[model samples]
Target: MAVAPTPPGRRERNKQAKLDRITAAASELFAEHGVDDVTTQQIADAADIGTGTLFLYARTKGELLLLVQNAHYASALERGRTAAAGTTGALDGLLALLSPVVECNRVQVDNGRTYLREMVFGDPTEPHHAEALSIVAQTERAIADLLSERTRLGGEEAAAMAGVVSAVMFLNLAPSATADASVPEILATMRAQLAAILPG
Candidate 1:
């Protein structure tokens, strides 16, 4: 049976309102002026919150970005899920699942290096960082499920493949100083790597 969601209390509602305002303000500022140029003070001012309160919500600028990106990443994951549902091929489905996330990350192109580093090694105690880690684990599980159901792979092998694919996805997300690589190139490389383990 389905359970209903709990109603937010006065305090929880107020906190959500504040978070919504902050996320909207940060998104607008980051859009108008790139993430690197926008300051936390400006974001606070735009959100009509005090600088100290901003710190309570997000300790650093990168964390602020993570806060702003929370909804966008969730939306991307939904889109990936929809795309994956329409595919039968294993590699193709996994790529479809990750494509939306990659595109979303591209929007923060200039902040890739810092964002990627913080996302992996940032303070786990922070709410937004914890959400990011949860999302990563969720994505990996989704991939493993696809492999197990659609391909001729055992449970353990499917999970191992998910880990390898996760590694490739992270490496691709990492900032590169060289010329840009398109999405096709990135997926082609991922497919080749996965082919080694997937049975024919």
Candidate 2:
């Protein structure tokens, strides 16, 4: 009798496994030491791979940083979209979108804050800076569309509100230089601010 053939999907699974290992190592290093302090060699060591192998996945330390941050955002966005799909109203959809962000911020507060600082105020000419900005813009547009569908707000107003909400969320994620606040406190404050800005 002929033996069963090996699954053809194993290669893709293996590749994803490697990527996950690298990303996890990068996230831990980045959280412990700021992105500026973490080197590619160190990342490779943390990931238990040769430096050259790390280079195959990331061109530079900045690229790795961006990759980590993008992965976080994308994951959260997927969760948000999934939650929003089940909601009945625009406000509910907006709440669903923001829920994942708030949850992510609480879970990965240190890494998320570091990534945001570098993305927003870092060298404007950097490619990651542009990419991060584009991602934010796209997210804002998605929020605006959701709002427009639920309320009487026009496109411009919805867009403006989305921008405002984005700004508030960014500020909420900022790392404290002194005393640290609890995650519950931060989420409560964010929720209150968002509620205040959204229409009744």
Candidate 3:
């Protein structure tokens, strides 16, 4: 009798299952306790895994936070990209691109603000700090590409515009406490600013 072969898909599924558990547990713990306060032991316990198992998924809490942050940004960017694809005008594409940032802000307004603060003003030499910067650069490039496709701007001009849009969006979505303003107030201010800078 020949032994049945283990399917490749099954191995992939198992790997994803483990990853899903780690992510979900981390999300819950990080949201409740804040990233700095949360520990791999707590995450492992929450996910019903051994400490060694948690390390297998994430060597450190900072790395795990980076992973989660990357996942969130990627999802939001993909949504914005999809929305922009349907728009005709450059401004419309920009607005579509902004939609996901707004949505993400709404979903995790407090946490988003906290993470941004940590990334921008915290220790710059940290490994995750560089990773965060790289992610922002990639996001800027994506926005630049969208603008270039929809407008007559040169690559430098497109990138500059995208950077401006990104800056405005970041200011708008910044934590109210940090800005001494509310979300609506910041967004309204940003909208007016974008209008002044971006050509119709």
Model 1 worst lDDT run, 10 consecutive residues: 175-184
Give the C-alpha miss distance for residue 146 in model 1, angstroms. 0.5
Candidates sorted by lDDT, best first: 1, 2, 3
Q: Which stretches of candidate 2 lie over 4 Å from their true place?
A: 1-24, 31-38, 47-63, 88-91, 175-179
My TM-score estimates for the predictions, one after another, are 0.87, 0.72, 0.71
What is the Å distance of residue 32 in model 1 from its true position?
Answer: 3.1
Instruction: Tell me each candidate's RMSD, in Å, in order.
Output: 2.8, 5.4, 5.0
Q: Which of the two candidates, 1 or 2, achieves a greater lDDT against the reference?
A: 1
Per-model CA lDDT versus the true structure: 0.81, 0.75, 0.74
What's model 1's overall lDDT? 0.81
Tens-digit per-residue lDDT, 1-200, candidate 3: 99999776987898788888888998888778777778898888888888897777666676667656767776777888889889887766777777776666555556677667756775556666667777678778888998788777889999998888888888777757544555456556766787688754
Please state the error at residue 192 of candidate 3 in Å.
1.6
Candidate 3 ranges with C-alpha deviation above 4 Å: 1-18, 31-39, 52-60, 118-134, 178-187
Instruction: In candidate 2, list every pair of residues with a backbone clash.
Output: none
Q: Give model 3's clash tally.
A: 0
